[model samples]
Target chain A: MVLNSHQRATIEAAAARIIPADHDPGALEAGVIDYIEQTLATHDGDHAQSYFDGVRELDELARRQFAAEEFSSLGPEQQDRILKLLEEKASPFFSLLVRHTMEGFYGDPRHGGNKDRAGWTMLGFPGPSYPKGYSSPLGWYDGHLPDDFASPKKRSDHEPE
Target chain B: MSRNEAVDVCIIGAGASGLVAAKELSEAGLSVVILERGPWRQRSDFAPEDEISTKRRHFFWPTVEQEPRTWRLNAQSPTEFLSADVQVFSNAMCVGGGTVHYSGLSWRFHESDFRVKSTDGSVAGTSIEDWPISYEDMEPYYEKAEWTIGISGKGWSNPFDPPRRRDYPVPPVARNSAGAILENGCRALGLHPFPTPMAILSRPYDGRPGCVNKGFCSGYGCPVGAKSSALEALLPKALATGRCDIRPLVMAREISVDSGGRAAGVVYIDSAGTEQFQSARLILLAAGGVETPRLLLLSKSSRFPEGVGNSSGLVGKNLMLHAPGPIVIAIFPEAVDGHQGSPCTRVMQDFYKTDSRRGFIRGGFVHPRAHGGDPVDYALQPVHGARWGLKHKDSMRESWRHYLHSHCTGESLPVESNMVDLDPEVKDRFGLPVARITYTSHENDIRLGSFLAKRSREIFEAVKASKVIVPPSRLRKLHNHQMGTCRMGNSPGSSVVDKWCRSHDMPNLFIIDASVFVTSGGLNPALTIEANAFRVCDYIVSEARRGNLG
Candidate 1:
């Protein structure tokens, strides 16, 4: 899919944060942002319409505040502030886009999003629980993963910039 | 001539009970044909985008078009359109019935539920007959049903519980932070807070996976086959036998009765829009609460007038709906991200016991739900209040952790006047008369709910909630757990069907579903419906062997 450089960069940043695979697999490296855009374009999912709406609404909202300049043209701090404002004005809309993007970035490939379960290995989430009921020893969660459960973007939830 | 269609049984309506019936019957060497009215959506259908499900309510099983034609207020008040939310009066049109979008709550009616008439001493002007069968009759079947549907939760005869045989298949879903808060408060006040019996595959059992806590599950089908629905769990097994044939989009218009007043076959509109007759020595109607009665009412013949089974004239009377009790949301300082656990993970049955002090005939279920904060739902939380430019942003910041919602599913008393009748003129996409629903909660209904609201508030306060909101009582809509239209009685004049759900007038025809419920349980009816269907299917198979269809 062809995305503007700035849109790609922003999505890449969001994807990189959600799928932080410091060592194992990576979110951006797993091509989650691409998955989000692709699902939005092809899946004909209900979430797709809202995202396109969010894109247009965010652009208009930002323009009302800072003229019709490109979102990427704004400094990183300015872009962050604009996102914060969007979060305030339309939290459901903004959160939904981000959340769906993450879901696509992390969901099972059967639904056409997280192609290889790469998103799972990255988050230390073992693939869907096997029917054996966890008799197997946790070779990894034997404490390799953090109990904090929050995604990277959610962890820095308040960071305006 | 070659046989174009062949099956020993054709089960319609893939719901809590039909699938159970199909699974067991199909396993016994009988060729079975299953027809579902809705689409077969699975977990792969959960897009979680702010679109189809949340907005359009797209997960419509066969689609909500077949909902009972119900009226609000009464016959005097013209029909008002009711949404699927007000009264869970919804039945899924697809392969799983309502189980596809169910919260996975699997509850057995307290033994008292069957003996409501004898145990509770009777109510004036109420035809509260004891259930033809007792809890003991269904004890083994309940266990069988649970194990088959793959229920997951710990079940002991909690002191307040009725008799039970085995424990739940898995540990209770971890109560989310809201449950923790409620549990602490409940224990402090000495009220029991037991983990609810759920049908979700908690640690993974059978062929399905466990829950990932995506949060918003109830209204959507589990793509992973983890949540037990007929489509995901039982019917698939039935179909795997190769003895069962599933025909989609075929609509059964009526039962064709032979001269002897026995149902010889059903005339159905196949997907091709052509009418076809599928002959059967025995016909079981699992078309659900709304359409089942509508079909019988439409199948008029010389032997029957009110419809196929209307000789008793009670085919569509006594339309009972479960009471949708007042909801109270108690806010806590901690992040009660309710979106984590299955919706009905915990409930307090303090009020389920029959009590006259409350001035009501029966009980209600007040349960905890950790449901829906996925964005649009979270933004509308009452705590968020009205939105301003900056204030709205502030609320959004706290969105994920700011809320928890609680619901009380209570009992709506049965009133003779609340019923489904054929409309004078209106018809559906099919030319059948619309299922006109005329209903109004009796004054006692309002009083009972009002009384329950007080208890709900007390529970919220005892839990040390930071904030509590109790919605006032104003003729609330019924939850979709609709039942009691084609009730059972020993006599044909009083009930539409015999105790076995066989139609009194038609003899060979059977009507089972929520429509056969003689009394609506105080809570969700899906489990009870499944239990009854399980019991009936056993009787059906054996009776068929004995040539009872004669």
Candidate 2:
């Protein structure tokens, strides 16, 4: 609700390009925009002005470069071009956008992002193993340790009886 | 304004040391009052499943705006106010303090660690001093702390470890993939690697459940009461005595002195923002390294113009923060699955001692990090060189489960210039001057860090890692391992506290935290802090019994 529908569309488009969907779901499908909006409304309210300014700048740059109506109307390749230019200029808004997009895509689902654990599923991560930790020989490397592995020295040598 | 009746002891900060002292004094039949600046959080309050809620939300610590700290390289450099996520010598402010969220790498300082001055001789421009107490003197208390607060490890496993009277209460936790790989690599190089000593429960001891390998050990509190924080282990006993009162959300503003120039009581702000005073016979400060010295500097009176314990003018000098070395990340062909156990399961202390041949007076330890498997943190890492687009997403998939990281923790020599002092400008939410830290790592620390980084690279190479990335060594702005603001010594002229950790100026004022450490050893300091608290409280109890404390 902090951003207008037009501004939200532009941000969603930028986020999609940053983590575009391939074989697996990306930022858009993971609801990264919701995370960004929720954060801007709450903990990161100070960054709200910058977000509005950045979205307007993105639209202006897209229209100037690609003869587009707005940034959200641009093709994927055109959007990538504008983002790269912003990155090359070391734009503060671009930096913020990238950081928040990654946070939303990868952060926990409780933050209004990573919907249905799509981001975790993409990386094959079994999210948050609390209340149930794995036992010994957790993975291939530990399971394959040789039987002749060296053991630690005996404590009985120094400890009192 | 409100006033409370006089108590036998008034302790500030319900942290690791304070909680231990509370249990000790209250059990010995003394009335105690503990004032904590933050809320008392239970195990259930921790959100292990949400990284945003636990790690990124400043859940354990205060926001940068709430308690801002300024930092500069040295007096010559311009000070920069740090952000919340920056390493600013911040510790958890809640009941158990940093122990609630620490990785639990419980280690006793090596024998040579105490006699740094005698062993290494004088290092130029450093205040490295031998501890008034020795390892032999601390051995019994170390054993007491390990048994009483549940540590799990195989004793004598680390050859470099100092002599001990007893083994750990429980065996070591299970090894994860990263630990296994590191262990194999270390053995290939003929170096010894042992199971890391942890404060977490391995098999149920002292009524707590054993670790299920919940994987979120370092930053998140144990939701199942498996981590042996002071909250789970010690404070319960203190409260059960019915003589101890833990007042949370109350900030101690100053240590008030009597007209006779002796110790008196404390003035604090209650949770409702009301000014209040609590009188006591004894005033103990365990408010961590930074806050402990800050409080001492703030408690100024006409009887003690330079602050209660500032007569020596060394109250806040000789600050030592353990320098974190290069973090080397390696990508292997196989899945490491590092996020299944404690943050670390194996540690190499082969390089822990001082080796003159290495071009550094002291050395550091290298260990395999279990944090590489964390999704959000790993994705945020700049190792891939690509910020966004298909390349970034592809790199995440390729390295998510296939990478492991190695870390080195080195000692920072105590430099007189690197210290905590009151900032002339910045103030906190309470309208009090914030602590300004001026630090520059000693040359020895830089040399030690680079040496350990090379060792870590070799270990990763031994395991046939496809790619190894060693980030350039950068100065750590600050570290969680804060030490040596009010160092302990034999003479009042050079140190704040004496061998018994009593303030040299105020006999009834004791400091039982890492602030009293004479030297910052090359290891995690939680176990040592707990042991020293036990030792100091024993001294206090003995003195009280003999009628010498009045």
Candidate 3:
């Protein structure tokens, strides 16, 4: 289920609105669109039709209200207005996109998003402390372990790109 | 080519109950063969410490895409298709069943739990009944389960606890910071908080090490064999007895009954996808609540058209799920770090028994928990108004460590309408009908849940913690303690299995799982199921020695 240029633009723009780019890397910089695309291509192909229907509806709404041809062509303010309409009318699609966006941004990097572990690093998460599990008799209330406890370079080095 | 074998007893599903039965029967010199639907998972299979691979990979449960179940809130509603991954009623499909990935809160139902109907009267719409066997009859078996399976906790701590023959086998697991905070709050409210009885090892026992506080026990298997899963505790001993043959990836299709109306053999799909018939003198069904009823419902013979041992038409009826009533969270300035120790290290059981003043038939327990263990799950919890970006980031940083979650584990009443049956339309990968669930919380259940939720709020307030968040009132569809599809009772008219977990209609067949639970108690049902398994095994062993059973 390859996404067309319009589909890709719509998804990327909508994902950016969910987690917009700022001083820190947001969903766009975190590669959430790629994550969603890969998910739709692989395990979650059943949800592809929902994405198509949602994008079409958003474009239709954009044409009616903002005099825009497509959702991606609109400015940030106009895009948010269309998103709010989607939240009201096509909530199932909007909520699904929001959930997938969160998964792509916050889930493990191996799933195709969270590039450079940006989502985790931004949230001060050290990924999973596998094999060598965390042990603190005093508990997590004491303090977090050093960031050096897990190395992103060493962690991603072993995995196939 | 398919191979045929014969054993004295053919047991389906090598989970908590089946493992115990196999060990007991094999040790008594009876040949036993156990058929497991899923692969034989070992410690190596549980190596993935990440939740994504462990949970998402379907390590503990069946994949919903290929094997789906249909669900409808009531009989009138249109059934919606749900993969086992998304289905709330699904349990483990591995070597040890749900015990492999269970949180290990090993609780014994109080004496009153066994006789809910007799003690508390009927709750209007529900058909609650007393078990054929009393708590006194089950006390010795509970002790045996504790000693053999190795539970860790002090006994007789809770005054509301039933009479115990002995204490737990080992000391309780060490408490995390939340345990201390919960204890202080409960004590301030004049409630007795005790160390929760858990199956996890607190000290090196039976060649297993103590818990190391890894903070991954909720849905993940223990890296070490400290969790006391059947895969870790019982199955190995059953295998050691050479009289037992444990075959994994062998799915039991149906039980074949002889002209005498007794279980004669089982036709199953082996790992190679070849059909094989394993003849046996006796058959035991321990395939959890859903699968046990499903297998029985699937095997419709001329003698039993409505399914075996279902003469009363109750084999797939009376399904009950525990209500994980509204959750109450307390916020503190400091990080209570709930993830560091056992998830259920301590519990306040002040309301374990029913009080008429509470306006509910039975009460629930307040068990404190740590919410934000991992980053992905922590990030999913949003602040009151923050959507994303810096505001969301700020909320995650400030609130993740500070929040402590506690729950009211309440009892769900067993209504005839709430049930598990075969889906007329949907089929699994094996080309068999998948289980369909029809359930809705009873009116009394909703009231009970609301009462419990109110109690949870009071406990959180007593702690003097900031930013208390009470989850919205809703009947949760999630099933942690699913039971009572094939209820056990004295009369064959009202039950599928008798007091000994043997099918009343089929003398040679037995069932020893949560399926035989007449009433689900307010607490977790793992320990009670294990204890009942031990009792049933003892009955089978003695009866077999007397030549009453094959």
Candidate 4:
């Protein structure tokens, strides 16, 4: 409810470019737009004005540069080109967009983003398992210490003066 | 709007020191009241797996917006309010304070740490003072604190560790991939590596379960009471004593003094926004380093115009935040799976002394850390050189499992210019002036940090890391390990508190926290703070028994 349909579309397109879908789910599929919208409506409500201004500016730039009706109407390649230009210019809006995109894609699914634990799944993270913690020999390196490993000799060569 | 009957003792902050003091004093049959500014969170309230809430957001309460602290590089620079996510100088305002979200690296300062000035001689532009008390005086209490609070580690494993009378309460936590790799590399290089002494339960001890290796430590509270925070180890005992009354969500505004220039009580704002006064015969200020001095400065009165116990004009001077040493991130071919246990398992203290050959007076410890598993934190790191698109994603997938960081923590020389004072303008939600911090790391700290970073790189190289990334060194802002604001010394003209941690100007007022630290050692300060609290509380109990604490 914090953003109109046009604003939402523009932000979703922007987030999609920031974390495009390939073999795995990306920002759009992970519901990054919903996360951004919810954040704007709540804790980060103060930045809503800047977000609106940024979205409008992005649309304006898309039309002026690519002859598109809006940023979302542009092809993936054109969207990427505009994003790269914004990045090169060190645009504050672009930085904010990228930061929010990452948060939505990587943050916990409880926040309405990273839907179905898509981010955790991609990273092979088993989320928060509190009551049940893992035992030692957690990885290949720990279980397979070098074959010639020996108990370290107690040496004071580097002892403090 | 309300006045409460006098208690035997009134302590501000239900933190590491205050809670310990409460348990000790109340057990000795003294009626005590503790005022904590944040909510008393239960174990169930902690979400160990949610990085966004626990790590990204200020899950510790009193976010920067709620109580803003302004900071500047030095007196000449303009102060800026710190952001919510800036980890620098951020302390949890909850019942356990920073211990609630701490990494549990418990350290006993070496003998040389107490006499830094004597050991290293004078460093120009720094106020390196020897502690009024020595390690020998603190050793017994250190033993007491470890046993009472449940520390887990092998005694004398760290050859650089100070002499101790007894071993830890429990054995060390099991080592993970990062620790094993670091051990191998360190042994190859002839460096000493030991299991880190931690304040977490390795096995079930004192009715608390052992850590589950949930990979959600440091910034997150233990959901299973595995972490031996003051909240878990001390507060419950204090409450059971039936003489310790903990009032959470109560902000102490000022330490009120009697007309005779003696400590009287504390004036605080209760949860319902009502002003209340709770009279006490004795007062203990354990509000950590910054807030302890800020509270002292806020307690200005006609009898003590320069603020209570600040006649020496050193109430907030000689601030020392432990130097943020460099971190070396390495990527190996095989997965480290760092998310299987606590971030740190092994520590190298080979350089934890004054080594002139290293081009720095004080040295630091290096530890291989397993803190790279969090997706949000991992993605936010700019080491990949790509901000977005397929390249960034590709790098993330490739490097997420293989990354391990070797972190160094060094000693920060106490500088007189670095200080905490009442801000000239900004105020908190209580309408009181906020604490303004002016700080800049000493040159020696930077030298030591960079030197340790190179050592870390050597360790990584020895382990055959595919890539070792050492970021450019930058000036550190205030870190979490704050110390030396209200210094303790033998001379009343040079320090705020006496060797017993009692205020020099007031007989009945005591400060039992890191604020009383004479010098910051090259390690975490939680254990020392707890030990000092025990020693100070013992003195308080004996004084109360003799009717000498008026």
The per-model lDDT (C-alpha) reads 0.64, 0.87, 0.79, 0.86
Point out where model 2 deviates above 4 Å: A147-161, B87-89
lDDT of each residue in B1-550, candidate 3, tens digit only: 3556678999999888999888888988999999999888887778544545566455677777656777888889888876443552467787888888888888878888899888998877798999998899899988998888889987887777888878888887766656666666677788887778898997799887887666667777787778988889998888899999999988898888888788888889987888999899889999988889999999998888988888989998999887647667677766676556677776778887887887778877877775526555555554335655456656766766667777777788889888999999999889999989888887767777777777666766675667777777554453757799999998989998899998989998999999899988888888899899899988888888898874
Predictions ranked by DockQ, top down? 2, 4, 3, 1
Please give the ranking of all candidate structures by TM-score, highest first, separated by commas.
2, 4, 3, 1
Lowest lDDT sum, 10 consecutive residues, model 3 chain A, at A142-151
CAPRI level of candidate 2: medium
Chain A TM per candidate, in order of listing:
0.53, 0.90, 0.82, 0.87
- The TM-scores, one per candidate, come to 0.76, 0.97, 0.90, 0.96
In candidate 2, residue B288 scores what lDDT? 88
Q: For residues B1-550, write the lDDT of model 4, one tens digit per residue.
A: 5899899999999989999999999999999999999999999999867877777767884577788888899999989987665543477889999888888989999999999999998989999999999999999999999999999888988888889888999887767778877888888899888888888898899999988777777788888899999999999999999999999999999999888888889999999999999999999999989899999999998777889999999998988987767668888888888888877777789999887887779877888888736777778788886889888888888888888877788899999999999999999999999989898999898888888888888888888889999987655666778899999999999999999999999999999999999889989999999999999999998888888986
Computed on C-alphas against the true complex, the DockQ of each candidate is 0.05, 0.63, 0.20, 0.54
Error of 3 at B32 (Å): 2.0
Poorest stretch of ten by lDDT in candidate 4 chain B:
B82-91
Model 1 RMSD vs true structure: 8.9
Between prediction 1 and prediction 2, the one with superior TM-score is 2
Q: Which candidate is the best by DockQ?
A: 2
CAPRI rating of model 1 = incorrect
The fnat of each candidate, in order, is 0.00, 0.85, 0.30, 0.79
The worst-scoring run of ten residues by lDDT in candidate 1 chain B lies at B48-57
Clashing pairs in 3: B64-B84
Native-referenced Cα lDDT, model 3:
0.79
